[model samples]
Target chain A: MRDRPATEARILEAAQAILIAAGPGGFGVNAVAREAGVDKQLIYRYYGGLDGLLEALGVRLAQWWQEKLMAGLPQTPVENYGELIELLALQLLHIVRSEPLALQSLLWELTGSESFVKSLSASRARAYGAWMAGVRGGLEPPEDVDAPAINALLIAAISQIALAGRQADTIIGLPTNDPATWDRLEKSLLRLVRGVYARP
Target chain B: MRDRPATEARILEAAQAILIAAGPGGFGVNAVAREAGVDKQLIYRYYGGLDGLLEALGVRLAQWWQEKLMAGLPQTPVENYGELIELLALQLLHIVRSEPLALQSLLWELTGSESFVKSLSASRARAYGAWMAGVRGGLEPPEDVDAPAINALLIAAISQIALAGRQADTIIGLPTNDPATWDRLEKSLLRLVRGVYARP
Candidate 1:
């Protein structure tokens, strides 16, 4: 009774851990109780139901996106547009590559048409957009730059490569599993960024 | 008795149709027999089994890629690198958006780990690389431009949008279902091209 907040926090953290590890499919009250070391009845009492637990988790995930995604980055505004993109893009690539939640959420977003997933997608979209904007800071490209489109393209490319590479080592013989390939990709990306985005 | 060539052609065509429409999951000897309007035994007798038929269909698909993917494009090389990429990216968008086969093949390639799909992926990769090279013709980007990376990014972006747009009306509030969004993407892509790739 005295540690209600601590208990709830433990439950939510466990829930998030499962969600990241196995995605939506593996989410279950039984698993949560087991992982959180709480009785199943406790979950029912604290959250009212499985849906309630899920909803709260969604909110928590959103807040975490802001905190974790924002903290410890180079916050100084980058005047060099190309370098800014490279920095932001590399950050995105690192997260997507290492974070199972991002990939799982993406898969769940695309596959599920349910209202729950839709709402989740909407919130994620907002969070992601905000994250991008926050990371970008005061960096502004020249008048001729199409920042939005370029950003979308870079995100799409990085995401697809990461997603597709999960099933195989190579996407179109690119050997995506190799770090050297990423280096090549980075080298090329930097070159293009330098070429297109004006140097400050 | 006299139409062995035609009957074989019909069966192969039906197989391709099924592969495109239903992907690998719907592929069945019985389905092919029914679609081709021939006895199931004929498929076994002619192709020597389903594997043979699949192999033949793979060959036919490769040939069709050469014939159809290459036909009627502006073969004339554009010295302007930006315009060249825009042209190719648009074509990829068009095909992926319109052709169920391309989408199906992509799905099949990613999801299936069997030898058959791997072979199909390999052949398709060869054909795609060839088509890209053939399309570029004599055009060349400046030494500063990272053409390969840019090309990979462009293809990834176009493909991801088209693929994800299959399930939902929008991707991260992009309104991908609308044609105008594509236009905006195009406008931005061209701008990036101009910014990066030098003029003729």
Candidate 2:
């Protein structure tokens, strides 16, 4: 209720922490209030309610993803499609490795029933689609390869690898936590992209 | 403690139904008993408890997946690695389309902390590794292509597609529910595999 920006930030931070620690199911108003050490009524007065709070969190998270993606993307038009693909792949892998909370938020969005989560996913898809269009316009992909499908496959693979890392240490003999494995993954992705998109 | 084998079948069926309908969170002895229209004591007597019931369900689902995978696999040794890869992709797509409950079981395994789920995932990974080994022995992939990494990528993509299908109908412009879209996906996969594995 107090028009304090710091209190709102603290609440949001606590909410994200709860999400990371307990997944979506543990994201409750009381838990968030306790985590933030703030009055429960302040949450109601500031964020309106739990759903509103979640929607705000979703917006923030989506913006964060978009910002990171944009930052990793080439500022000028991509001259080399192969390098652009590699850069995008490594950026995604880096996010998954470094941002556990963000990863959890994505997992929650995928499995959650909230309308806001669906909207967030749709928005992300649109952003991804727009980005792909820009990248495609800048380079000539091989005729045999469906560029969009390949992009989807690569993105999906990286995402699943990230989510699976939370539960399992290895996948099909690839060490999930080892830096060497990540290097190999990056190299493999670079080669795959080059093979599929780079003209001879 | 009924001696009739049909009761056990009913209990197991109910357990699976609950799993599909409400995920692992709804899988309780009381819920299963109510879903089966049987006394709660029957679940205890037949399956011992919720943990034992989950184990039985896991075993059955794993066996079913194994059967489906084996049926779709090449009967003899795979002579063409490209064709083998295509077959594996199709088999995975089939399972995702036809077996919703089994997919739920896998999602549960990925998210749940139960020891049985962990063991089941491990066993399946081992099976996948063995199958990959056999496929690798049959053909020579290109020098730049990492067979194991490719296998992992394909499997992870299929899994994410299946899991994503439950939440969203379309992914990156690909219609998840449309047969045509699936056909396109198969073709794209085949092309990718051929590109990666076909003799240069």
Candidate 3:
């Protein structure tokens, strides 16, 4: 119990590494303990078990993701939603590339666990709802905007980009610090968002 | 040998099943032979080794994927790229959902093998080059729509949506045939495309 706080952080870090290397199915207690250089019993005592560890990690990752997503957006609101989307896409690519392991772990759990999947959907719904509230600069989506639909689309699109960024990293064996492909991705996303948000 | 064709087909089928169940690393000669209900020795007689099997599978699967992707496009090109994008999104969602096993295998190899990744990049370049040739239907892009840039965006956006669709199937345990989600996605994508293709 004395080492509980540090143990939690260590377990999360170790879990992220295990997930990055072997995905969700490979997240074993022994592996995590060994990776963390901690006692197995300490992991059990600190996080309760694998499920608890995953739950904590999921919550942590979601908050981090939302914060990173919201970081590039202006505090108030903008008339052009495309601008926001473009920023969001670049920010998303940046964040995922920065923290590939955590994002990959979340994605793996999204595929591997039903409970985790539900949690992810709920969390996403909440985040998008919040984002939409801010999208029109406090006012709801304009009549022609189809706010809910737009929100869903943006969430889906950005989520895909973030995931694809991870896949791109794996494919080209690029380091997180490299911004070459990211520059290309950012340009493309800007065009796509402009397509969605620019006036007809 | 006399059963070369049969042996090759069996190997391909086995690789697909393994990809669906355990991904690329789990695909071994022993597993493939077992799954195909054939002698292990036959794998060597026909394919020479595991790498051969992977190469043969890659060629076969890539060809199959290309055919499947081209199956549902409008017979003739439409002036409004937005409508075409919607159609393409729906078609892609259908393809990704229905062919999860194949997609999984293709993605696994695309990221895992260096030579395969190079070929995949070349294939993508060709597809993008072709798409850019048709970027101008009636509307003009706000900025110069370079082939690489447009391709990167279009490919990223489409890939993201497809990945979402797959997750809805494999992770969220949602019905892959749910037209409502696809319909919503199509509208959003169409709007995005329109926003991009609109006159500056």
* Tens-digit lDDT string for candidate 2 (B1-200): 54569889998998888988987666789899999989989778778888889889888777766666666656667666666777787777788778887568667755777778766776667766555565656476556677777777777777877777677767766777788777666666666666666643
Question: For residues A75-105, what per-residue lDDT tens digits would candidate 3 score against the true structure?
Answer: 6556565565555556555666577664564
- Which structure among the candidates has the greatest DockQ? 2
* lDDT, residue A75, candidate 3: 67
Better of 1 and 3 by TM-score: 3
Using lDDT as the measure, what is the rank order of every candidate, best first? 2, 1, 3
Off by over 4 Å in 3: A1-5, A20-26, A41-49, A73-83, A131-136, A159-162, A165-181, B1-4, B20-30, B41-48, B77-90, B105-143, B168-178
TM-score of each: 0.73, 0.88, 0.76
lDDT values, one for every candidate = 0.71, 0.74, 0.59
Candidate 1 overall lDDT versus native: 0.71
lDDT digits (tens) for residues A41-71 of candidate 2: 8889889999899899988877877776666
Top of the candidates by TM-score: 2
**TM-score of the second chain, cand. 2:** 0.83
Residue pairs in steric clash, candidate 3?
Answer: A194-B195, A195-B195, A195-B196, A196-B195
B186: Cα error in model 3, Å: 1.2
Candidate 2 residue-wise lDDT at B196: 65
- Candidate 3 positional error at A56, Å: 2.9
Count of residue pairs whose backbone atoms collide, per candidate:
1, 0, 4
